[model samples]
Target chain A: MPAVVSLSNVHKSFGALQVLKGVSFDVAAGEVVAVIGASGSGKSTALRCINALETIDSGEIVVCGHKVHDPELDRRALRRDVGIVFQSYNLFPHLTVAQNIMLAPTCVKDMGKAEARRLAEEVLAKVGLAEKADNYPEQLSGGQQQRVAIARSLAMQPKLMLFDEVTSALDPQLTGEVLRVMEDLARGGMSMILVTHEMAFARKVASKVIFMHQGKVWETGPGAMLANPQTKELAEFLSNDL
Target chain B: MSLTPVHIEFIATGALWTVGLSAIAFVGGSILGFALALARISPVPFVRRCAGTYIQIVQGTPLLVTLFLFYFGLAVVGFDSLPAIVAAGLGLVIYSSAFLAEIWRGCLESVPKTQWEAAECLALTRWQRMVRVILPQAMRIATAPTVGFLVQIVKNTSLASVVGFVELAQAGKLVNNTIFEPFTVFIVVAAFYFVICYPLSAWSRSLERKLNAGRR
Candidate 1:
């Protein structure tokens, strides 16, 4: 099957320091792929490059068959197909959860307000916070806000979703709430690329796991690879630093 | 000499003009200043540079100089029949826009980079992202500052007296000249300004407190 997302020799540099040095990976349709790596291993940079948040110095990042390497590429169209959730859950503080979700659909997609609000309500219900739609981001718990962020992306009906260390910013219980929503998305056949430190979730939910170390893919295999990683880097990565 | 009721009414009339002019400047300048702030952040390099130059020129020159330049320049350009109210109104807008543009630009920049990324990921165009995401949040951070700028605008309306506008300060000067009551007339004029500016200042402070209340 053709991959939903593809990256080849993705090199990114911030001044002289290169973060993603020739990183490559492929995410198939409806697949939940976790990219596990240590801090500064370029996992987030790779995710960002896929959405053109950070320009790649040299490489190709194609999301759902659209190449993002060219500066002239229609970013807005590229974005409509690819959704991203951040660790911080960057919801608009001024707007309520429903307004946040309704913004893009009504404004970008040009959907009617009533239709967008209806879709937002449906998605908010799916995320298990339909009643909290009127609450502002600050009024909701961190976990609730993150779920709303996820729902906001889902409301856009993106072809692929990228999660960059989403739960790393949450408390343990809060992390569980977000992970539960992600699992629901996974089961529903949504394509996802997750950058996470939660080994157990990665092991259970991920169809494939790519172990990145020092800006390169150190190993790759099925979810069982987390049980007995081939490389020393993967072993260390899976081992609890505690 | 005992202050006459006529003197009090005279000051009151002038005070009303102060408020009217301030309302004009705040509303007019805010609309123009918002666009100026957007220009400062525009993707086009030349637009950004032009905005930067505008900000510098307005900020570097004194408001007094700008008022003088505009007042005389209008006459020189054959619009000599322009009322002092119109000339001074134009001057205050230019002055207020520069300060407000800088204020709002800071607020806009304070919105997290991740917010922009997330909006882009949602495929919202630049304008959509700004209207939908960035500005909403930025406006939260902007509210107190924008209202606070209103106080400055109100007080600065007094400066219009220099251009022959019969606002409170200039009206006070006229009354004081006849009565030789600089101490009393100027003091009352100052009180009028205080009354107009103090409420706006309080409103701004309350807004700031509300915005920051979520932190704890």
Candidate 2:
């Protein structure tokens, strides 16, 4: 099957600081690719480029058939096919959980209020947040707010999901809940690319693992590859992660 | 020429004109102010500069000078015989819009950067992101200051009297001139100003309290 997400020779920089240099990866349908690296390794930049959130300096990214690098790329359509969750759980504090989820569909898709509300409820239930739909973001715990952020993305029903250190801010117990939701998504055949630090969770849930070092993909293989690091950098990264 | 109940009634009616002028200035200023705020944050350098220049010029000049410029200055330049009310209302709109634009720009910027990123990732159009996400949040931060500004608007209508508009302060001057009772007449006028301004100040304080309640 063709890859749902493909990045070839992706290069990105913020001014003089090159973050991603000639990086490449592919995520086929229903595949879970966990990207693990130290901060500033460009894993997050690579993920952001796939969603066209950060435009690439050079290279090509095609997500769900949209040519993201093309200047004329239809961003709305591309975004509709890709959902992203961030570490900060950037929920709209002024909106209720259900309203936050409903906003995009109702505004962008012209979905009727009743239909969007139903979708909101369905996604909230999916994230185990059905009871918190009417609550504001500030009223919820950090984990709960993060879950609502996940549900907000899920409500869009994208072809692929990008998670950027989504559980990094949560405690261990809270992280477990988020990981379980991701595991459920993977089992339900949703394609996902997650930048994460949870080694055990990555090992268990990631079908493939890409270890990044210094803006390049240093090592990649099945989940078991993490158990036996070939390069010293990978070994050091894995040890530090533990 | 004596201080009579009739003159008090006339001044009270003039207070109505003061309220009307403030409302016109605020509503008109709010619309223009919102546009100016957007221009201030526009991505294009030229548009941003233009808005900045407009703010600087309006803010630098006194409201009295602005009124004179609109009333007498326009007459000097061949648009003769404009009504004093039109000139006064237009001057206040221009004045209030500049200050309001600056006030609202701060409110808009106070919304965190992550909120913009989050909204953009959702694939919302620029207008959608602003109306749905940014502006709603900014409105909360703006409410107290906006109400406080209204009190300024009320007091500033006194300046409109110079252009021959008979608002409260102008009416006070006419009564004082006729009755020769400057102390009594001016005191009553000041009382009228106080009555109009105090509730707005109280409301602004209450809104500030309500907004901060969630933070604590």
TM-score versus the correct structure, for each prediction: 0.93, 0.94
For model 1, the DockQ equals 0.58
Q: Estimate, for each residue in B1-216, the C-alpha lDDT of model 2 and write its tens digit.
A: 678999999899889999899988999999998899999988899999999999999999999999999999999999995798889899999999999999999999999988998998888998999999998888889988898898899999999988889999999999888889999998989999998889888887777666554343
lDDT of each: 0.87, 0.91
Which clashing pairs does model 2 show? none
Candidate 1 lDDT score at position B119? 76
The CA lDDT at B18 in model 1 is 91
Q: Which candidate is the best by TM-score?
A: 2
Which regions of candidate 2 fall more than 4 Å away from where they truly are? B1-3, B178-183, B202-216
Model 2: reference contacts kept, as a fraction: 0.61
The residue pairs in collision within model 1 are: none
In the order shown, the candidates' DockQ scores are 0.58, 0.58
lDDT for each residue of candidate 1 in B121-149, tens digit (9 for 90 to 100) = 77777887888778867877898878878
